[model samples]
Target: MKTDRIMWGIVLLFIGGVLLLENFNIIEFYWGRVWRFWPIFLIIGGVNILFTKNKSQIAGIISIAILVITLGILFYKGQQPRQKEVTISSHTEESNDLDIPRDVTYSHPYTDSASVKTILNISGGGTSFDLKGSTDSLIIADVQRKLGNFSLETNKTDSITSVSFKMKGKSKWNMGEGGNDVDLKLNANPIWEVHMNMGAGEVDFDLSGFKVREFNFDGGAAALNIKFGDLLPITDVNIKTGVADVKINVPVASGCRIKTKTGLSSKDFTGFTKLEEGLYESPNYKTAVKKIFVNLDGGLSNFEVKRY
Candidate 1:
């Protein structure tokens, strides 16, 4: 057999076997742990190039052995527990030193009438953001930061309110250092439209109690989980991501249509039927009163939509 063919076969088999084991719950692999070792691919390519002129059996065997050993190391490291970073808590003591990190709380009053429409804009990176429960105020944000600063601003126009929450400066990563964390709560009265831009981090939002009109997210190398309710006549969701894991939950009774433009990505739309290329629809799409439209565009990511 050709040496190139042998190398390609081994690569495919390793990837297939790892995915199979992950699907069967035999081993949990953390891709983040393996991401830093991406330079190994460059080394492998160099090795193959060096041996290209020599088509001897010994050269092929050496290449295969190196590949196997590199893969073995990655497999072992992926299953190991990640080291925990030191995190700052809200109750941490205050210090006179300016270098000490501190917790901050921010809120915007719910002064607008219930009939008003509200838009929330969020932008940040290297942080964990969560939205859950309802608050009497328009919005409440509690931030715990080890570096950088956060800002919240609100503006109201005729029949509409806009709230913006964002990190002010870039965050620098240090070894064994903690990251910023933000917890957010929103009022349930106003019809909401949420837009978020995240460079990298984790996001968990439960908008099941609010009347959400539209939701949008743009992120890179992040994990996102969102659950939506059937409180509105129609809900629109749009997401664009790169190298991320995204999961969305929708009500089973609500009709849903999904359209995706994904390149080198995996999708699991379990309860939806394919209507056409890049289009899927729930079974009750035609008859259901409440409907949801979802559009997803991603590169090298995993997308899953489940009914709850």
Candidate 2:
């Protein structure tokens, strides 16, 4: 009985840590998806109690192993990327309903300008989004949505260009007939500070061609695959994830340093030297002129960093 209680206590503490990270935007948990597996907890507890009553030590060990395997599968599934087909439709506002078009596609073309710094803010609720580098001199975007009022607002002041996207109103999370999606391609010439808040879904980000000064990403119940190609003199990258799998690829020549704080997550820093607990540095980190600093806080997620 004592052993069972201790095991349950440990389980509860693990769950509490995951929840705390979720609240801080370091992780996102969708109860609806995993609620069905709630019985697993009860089963584990029941098996543990049975072992205590019978004094079957092997049974207790088996129960714990089963629980671990189940949780591992759940984590693996959560990190898998999901694909959705979303088409771009013409924008038309008829009547006051803000009725969403079936193929509502908006393209913002790029025009050559003297802007040197780009500030981008991305906010979406339950939307699948894609981001990549653009060949044109101007930052371009093609946004498509099936429901809610989607807005792409931009501003420019001197050499700084600011762009923001939001799915306005409470209906942002409402997935109507076809679903919601945002596909963005931006010019990679200017220096950038990209801030992204993804409510849910999958994000595929490729920053290979852009000179990123600072990249901040916060996600909830999402899968992220990010590749960093080029970086600024002093690059700062901060990422927080919840109930997701995050994989980052760094350039071969760039010096990289990673610091992490995690809860119930597996971390793999391939080819990096572990200076100490929770600190990792690349081979050329000290000698390279350009450096990339990565700080990651994760909850109930899997994180991996690799050099390409």
Which candidate has the top score in TM-score?
A: 1
lDDT of 1 by residue, 240-275 (tens): 997677889999999999999988667889989998
Worst 10 residues of 1 by lDDT: 170-179
- Candidate 1 local distance difference test against the native: 0.80
In candidate 1 the C-alpha lDDT for residue 36 amounts to: 47
Error of 2 at 89 (Å): 4.6
TM-score of every candidate: 0.77, 0.69
- RMSD (Cα, Å) for all candidates, in order, is 4.6, 8.0
164-219, model 2: which lDDT tens digit per residue?
87677543233313346566777767788999886555568888877888889897
| Candidate 2 segments exceeding 4 Å error | 1-101, 107-115, 135-137, 170-179
- Count clashing residue pairs in model 1: 0
